[model samples]
Target chain A: AQSVAQPEDQVNVAEGNPLTVKCTYSVSGNPYLFWYVQYPNRGLQFLLKYITGDNLVKGSYGFEAEFNKSQTSFHLKKPSALVSDSALYFCAVRDIRYTGGFKTIFGAGTRLFVKA
Target chain B: GAGVSQSPSNKVTEKGKDVELRCDPISGHTALYWYRQSLGQGLEFLIYFQGNSAPDKSGLPSDRFSAERTGGSVSTLTIQRTQQEDSAVYLCASSLPGSYGYTFGSGTRLTVV
Candidate 1:
């Protein structure tokens, strides 16, 4: 079974500092990795996805993710954090070889707090 | 619609009653999905539907939970005998065939008292 893990329950960072939310995944074959953001009482918004051909993928609102195949990690990163960036982050994975369907497995989620 | 649309942004029902949530996917989207989001628990996959194919109901929690997609555009998720544990936001997402990302709606906040 394909699964994704977000080791951090919450990550606190200072405004203007770099921020990173870690994610890792396990799958039988190549994995399709995605990052999503959720604001208070809002549905998830897609951040970025690593389908193929690129190790680093940039997404909406100055967010980017680095896909590390060796470590099975796709960590969400931002060069400088802002107060508005504080929200819940989720890492999801989809196995390319899965015959069932295109159902993505999401991690438990990591709450990000950027203090000003 | 420009994006996925879900009806009844908020819903409150008495326990043991039935509730239905609706979703309208983006125009031309070939796939639609239903997920549940609780306070702490992450998004839980509920069901999936593709153009005219048999929906993957594997993620449904119980027999009382059922869903139907009409004309491959609009979908309805019905939860019979709603319980307090079912109080959570139900989200709907849609994507084009083989698309890498999904566009999600604002979601319907269902509260079962």
Candidate 2:
């Protein structure tokens, strides 16, 4: 079964400092991992995805994530955080060879708090 | 619409009532998905519709929960005998067949009184 785990429920960081939100996954086939962000009263927005090529993928809002196959991890990172970066982050995964319909398994989500 | 769209931004109904949530996927997108979000809990997959294939309903919690996509573009999720536990934001998303990234709607917030 395909699944994602976000070890930290919440992450705290100061403005202008680097931040990292960890994620790991388990899938039978080649993993199609993605990162999404959700702000207050807003639906999830796609941050980035790892389909193939370059392990580090850049996304909107100056965010990026590194896909590590050996460690089964795809961690979201930002060089310098901002107060507006505070939001909920989710890690999701899917398998390439889908059987019936598509199912993107998601982690419980981590609440990011970038204190100003 | 430019992105996935959901109807009834907010809905309140008494327990035991039935409710229907609608989703309009982006033009030309073939896959649609439904999920529920609750306090402290992440998104829970409800069902998925892809092209003309039968929806994958394994994630549906019970028979009272059902969904259908019409003409492979518009989708509706229905819940019968709604309970307080069902009060949560119902989110809809759509994507291309091979694409892993999904475009999500603002979601419909349902409150079961």
Candidate 3:
């Protein structure tokens, strides 16, 4: 089974300061990791994904994530946070072997609060 | 190009009532998915449509929950005997074949009173 873990229930950061939302996963095969953000009353918006490339992957809205195989983690990072960036974050993992079958499993989700 | 679109942005119904939510995928997208987001469950996959075939229905919580996609474009999710626990945001997403990024719809908010 492919599963994702977001250790933090919520994260608070000051605007203009760097922010980090932690995520980890467990899978039977190679992992296809993804990050998505959801605003109130809206569907989730895709941020970035890590297939099989560089360790660091950049995404929309000045966000990025680092894929660490040894740690089994893919934490979302942003150098500078904005108040508007406050939203719910989810980490997802899809096993390569089940690419055509099973759906991607998402983490419980982490609420990010960027305060001014 | 338009993004995924879902109908009945918000629906309120009494217990035992049935509701139907519709989704229109992008013009060329071959993959469509339905997911439910609740306060306790977060986001849970309900069903997925690849072209006109749905190979996985394991995500549906119960027999009351059913979905179908027709002509490989439009999809409908029907919930029978609506329960208060079913109150949540139902989202739809579509993507191209072998594409990793998914385009999501605004989502329909279903409130079972």
Candidate 4:
């Protein structure tokens, strides 16, 4: 089974400070990790993904994530936070073994609040 | 369409009624997916359609839920005898073959009263 875990239910950060939303995963084979953001009443927007690439993957809205195979983690990061960065962040994973036929499992989600 | 499109931005229905949610995936995309999201919860996979292959219906929660895709383009999800528990945002997504990411629709908010 492929699963993702976002440890924090909510994260608060001051504007201009770096922010990190933690995510960990479990998979039987190589994992395809992804990050998505959802605003109120809107669908989730893809941020970035870690396929088979460099350890760091940059995404939309100045966001990026580091894929650590040893730690089984793909934590979303931003060098500086803005008030508008507040939203719900989801971590998802898809296993390469094709056990469930392209079903991507998502984490419970983490709410980020960037205080001005 | 440039992105995945879903119909009936919002729907309110009485309990026991059947509701249909529609989705139009982007042109040329071969993989389509349906997912349900409850308030403040993660997405629950509903079904997946890839090209002409038989869909993977393992994620459908119950017999009351069903879906179909026509010409491998437009898709509809039907929920019969709707209950309050069925109320949630139904999201549709699609991707090109072998694409790692999905383009999602705004989603249909179904409220069963």
Candidate 5:
């Protein structure tokens, strides 16, 4: 089974400072990883995905994630954070060959608090 | 183009009652999915519908949770004998076949009392 792990329950960063949210995955073949953000009472919004390409993938709202194959990690990053960026973030992973037919397996989620 | 839409933005029902949540996917989308979100938690995949194939219900938490898609368009999720644990935001998403990104609806908040 493909699974994702977000070791951090929450991450705090001051406004204008860089932020990093850690994520790791376990899967059988190649992995398709994704990042999503959720605001209070709102559905998840896609941030970015890694489906075999450059290690660093850029996404919406000035967000980016680095895919490290050696460590099986995909960490979300931002050069500078804003108070509005405070929300819940999730890391998901899907096996390319599992074919058990599922969308993706999401992590427990990490609460991001960007203080102003 | 309009994104995915769900009805009954908020639902409050008593225990042992039945509830139905509706989802209208983006026009022309062939893949639809249902997910559950608890307060301050990540999404839990409930079910997925792809074209005319049988839906993947492996993620459903219990037999009381069931979903169906009509004409491969609108979908409905029915929860029977709802429990307090079932109270959460039910989200719906749609995507094209083989698409990477899924457009999500605002979600229906179901509260079981």
Candidate 6:
């Protein structure tokens, strides 16, 4: 089974400072990772995805994630934070080797609070 | 549609009653997915519909939960004898073939009282 884990339930960062939201995963085969953001009263928005290439994946809103094969982690990062960046973040994983079908599993989510 | 759209942005239903949530995936999107967002369970995948193939019901919690996509465009998720635990936001998303990023709707907030 493919699963994702967001270790931090919440992360607080000051405006203009760097922010990092951690994510780890476990999959039977190669993992196709992705990040998503959800604002209050809205559905999730796609941030970025790591399909096959590039350990460092850049996403919407100046967000980027580094995929560490050894660590089985894809941590989302931003060079500078804005108060508007506050939202819930989710990490999802899809096992590319799964012959059965394509199913993406999501993490519990981490709440991001960017204080200005 | 320019984006995925879900109907009944907010829904309040009596416990034990049946409720149906609808989703209109993005036009030309070949893959549609249903997910439930709740405080306890977080975001859980309910079902996945790709083209004309059989829908994946593995994520559906129980028999009380059922969903159908008509003409490969509009989808409706039906929950019979709803429980309080079923109260949460139901989100719908769609993706093009071989596309990793999915566009999501605003979601329908279902409240069972």
- Better candidate number, 1 or 3, judged by lDDT: 1
lDDT, each prediction: 0.92, 0.92, 0.89, 0.92, 0.91, 0.90
Off by over 4 Å in 2: A96-101
Candidate 4 has what TM-score?
A: 0.97
| lDDT per residue (tens digit) for residues B1-113 in model 2 | 79999999999999999999999999988989999998899999998888888778878999999998989999999999999999999999998877778999999999999
Cα error of candidate 6 at position B73, Å: 0.9
Error of 3 at A19 (Å): 0.5
Encode model 2's per-residue lDDT on A23-110: one tens digit a residue.
Answer: 9999987888999999998989999998889999999999999999999999999999999999999999985457544578889999
Find the candidate with the highest DockQ and give its number. Answer: 2
Off by over 4 Å in 6: A97-101
Each model's backbone clash number: 0, 0, 0, 0, 0, 0
Q: Is the docking of candidate 2 incorrect, acceptable, medium or high quality?
A: medium
Q: Is the docking of candidate 4 incorrect, acceptable, medium or high quality?
A: medium
Report lDDT (Cα) of residue A79, candidate 4.
99
Candidate 3 clashing pairs?
Answer: none
Q: Score the docking of each candidate (DockQ).
A: 0.60, 0.69, 0.58, 0.58, 0.58, 0.60
- Candidate 4 yields a Cα-based lDDT of 0.92
What lDDT tens digits, residue by residue, belong to model 5 across residues B28-69?
998898999887677898999988888988889999999999
lDDT of 5 at A82: 97
Tens digit per residue, CA lDDT, model 5, A1-116 = 78899999999999999999999999888889999998876778999999988999999999999999999999999999999999999999864543434387789999999999
lDDT of 6 by residue, B1-113 (tens): 89999989999999999999999999998789999989745589999998988888888999999999999899999999999999999999998887777888999999999
